[model samples]
Target: MVTYRSAGVDIDKANEFVKFIKEKVKKEFNLEEFGGFASGFPIKGYKKPILFSTTDGVGTKLKVAQAVGVHNTVGIDLVAMNVNDLITTGADPFIFLDYIATGKLDLEVMKQVMEGIIKGCREGEVILAGGETAEMPGFYPEGVYDLAGFCVGLCEEDEVITGKEIKPGDLLLGLPSSGFHSNGYSLIRKVLEMNNVSYEDYVEELGKKVWEVLLVPTRIYVKEIKKLKKNVKIKGIAHITGGGIPENLIRILPEGTKAVVYKKNIPQNPVFSWIQRLGNVEEREMFRTFNMGVGMIVILDKEEFDKARELIPESFYLGEILAGRKEVEIL
Candidate 1:
């Protein structure tokens, strides 16, 4: 007689993992119940609320985390990717859910990942609603796992920033990224392999080991955007991710307006320069692949630029919008 445990699927272990998640959510989010089929929270304070949802995964960056035996930061990356996108519409993310899957259960690793998730939720002011932990025997390797996150946000109907307000003469403002911010790791790993570089190896330019820089948790822009909203009238916002500035910035432009960005003013982070030197990557490819440095771009009227700058001192004056075909130019 074969049992589920004998077949490498331990129902008891999965139950225990669910209980573990419940405890974490209870402590972190002050929830009285968890492990439910669906999670929810009541909404308030908006006379006319519009709901926005976003889903994203950490992508190949998870492989790097597994390689380095660090499972925490990627949880933050998961939340950052989703919440940042939701906020572009001027929504306040209120609830977040996560999904984790692996070939076998590892309690300790899951716990560490959960801790990072809780931290990220707290920082983003999102509730740890609920999540799923699947242990699939044949689908994944024993030590490898994957993560995906879902975020829901609420905004007033009149307050939604649809980018329709963005027009010619609006100034582009760029907020610096924490690092790579969970994109382009496939190319990064390939570059490392071609250079015969190890994640443990330290490079002089970046001032840290490869894995350390790569593992830097993506910055959550919720607080900064919220603060800026109070003082500045932001016409549009873009979260720079896989497609980089050229692809992301163009997204918020109106049909006839174009964006012009000054590459010289981008304040290229050291890691990008290192990757370019090692991989011999072209400038265009680099901009299209990585954030280069800016993580979030905000569109504002020329007159409001001074106030927005005063609020976010680290922001750089990227460029201005102009009348043209819908596209982007990085000079």
Candidate 2:
């Protein structure tokens, strides 16, 4: 007779992992039925609540974390990616769930990853509702795992920002990013590999090792967006990801209006310059691949620009809308 354990799946280990998670999050989050088939969260305090949901992964940035033996920050990256996208719709994220899969469960590494996730949830003010941990011996290589996160948020029906009000003469404001926030690492890895550079190698320009820069957790803009919306009539919002500014920002532009981003206005991250010099990447590709420096963009009326600055001192004047095709231009 064949047993389930003989097939490489360890039931006892998975049970223990679940128990560990419950113990860590029991006090922090008020999820009484976390281990059940599904988690529950009560929604209240909205006149006409609109639900928003998003899911995202850490991308190849995971490789850098694994290579560097840093497993914690990637969990934060997972939460940031999902929550940041949810906030782009001007929603308040209230619950978060994660799925982690590995060949053989490494309790210590998974624990570290959970810690990071908990930290991100706390920072974003989202509840750690529940999640899953899958252990398949033959499915994934030993000591290797993948992570994905799901987030649910809600906003008042009247408060949803859909970029319908965006028009010519509106000003664009940008929130600076924390290095390359969980995107374009595949190209980054390629650049390093082709040049025979290791993640452990130090780059003087960046003042840090390669993995250090690569593993920088993505910024969670939930709080900042909430603060700005109360004071400014935010016409549009964009979370710069996978496709740099042009691809992400264009999604929020109204018809007949285009965005022009002044290169001079952008405070480019040093890592981008180093990558360009090392990989001989074109300027257009650099802007297309990386966040450059700006992580989030807020579009509002020109009259409100001063007020926005007072609220977010770190935000810079990015560009303005123009009467043209619905698109984005990085000058």
Candidate 3:
């Protein structure tokens, strides 16, 4: 008879790993029905609520973590990847689940990963409802794993912040990024290799090791955006990820409106300038790939500028919306 273990898949080991997580799930999550095929999340009281969800991975940030021997923070990166997108629609994320695939199951490493996930969940105010762990011996290298997460949120139909309300006179307010919030790492890795710089090398500009700079977990903007929604007439929000400010901003822009982001106006981290010169990367490529500094873009109505300014007093004046076609331009 054919067997599963011979095919490099460990079913029993996966079960044992889940066994370890279940006890903690009950104690920490109050989840009695933990190990079922699907998880149950209890949410209620949505009068005209619409559900929003997103699935995302941390990209090559995981490789940076592997090269640095740090796994904890990437779990936060994983959670941030999904929940940040959910918040773009002005929805409150209620629950999230993770998928972890590995060549081998290292319980210690897995535990550390879970630690960051729990921490991220607390930051986003979302529960870690359930997750899956798979061990495929040949698929991934030993001591390496990949993580992705799915997040679901709820918001009233009328409360959605779609950029349809954006107009020519609107201003774009940008929130500062902690670092390269979990995107462009593949190119970053390429840049590193081209420069022959090791992850352990300390760069004076960053005042830290290379891996530490690259592995900084993505910021979860769920709480901040929700707070701003209460005080400001936020026409739309763009979670700057892989596409950076230019691509992500356009996602929410209404027709006949163009967003012009001024490069000099953004508060940039020194590391970006360092990398740009080192990699010979152009400005448009920098804006398209890395966040360059702005992690989240908030489009505020001209009338609500004062109230919004009061809220994010230090927000960088990225640019203004202008009457044009549905597109984004860097000024």
- TM-score of predicted structure 3: 0.94
Per-residue lDDT tens digits for candidate 3, residues 174-290, read 888888898888888899899999999999887998887887888888778888988877788899998888789988988788998888887868989888988999988988998
Per-residue alpha-carbon lDDT of candidate 1 for residues 1-331, written as tens digits (9 for 90 to 100): 9998887788987888788878878888889967778876778788999999999999999999999899989999999999999999999999999999999888889888988898999889999898888888989987999999999999999889989999899999999999899999999999999999999999877889999989999999999899888898889999999999999988888899999999888876888898999999998999999999999999999999999998989998988999999999999
TM-score of 2: 0.97
lDDT of 1: 0.92
How close to the true structure is residue 215 of candidate 3, measured as C-alpha lDDT?
79
lDDT of each: 0.92, 0.91, 0.85
Per-residue lDDT over 212-303 for candidate 2, one digit per residue giving the tens place of the 0 to 100 score: 87888999888889999999898999999989998999999989999999979887689889988889999899889999998999999999
* Candidate 2, lDDT over the whole model: 0.91
Q: Candidate 1: misplaced stretches above 4 Å?
A: none
The candidate maximizing lDDT is 1
For candidate 3, what is the total of clashing residue pairs? 0
Better of 2 and 3 by TM-score: 2
Q: What's model 3's lDDT at 186?
A: 81
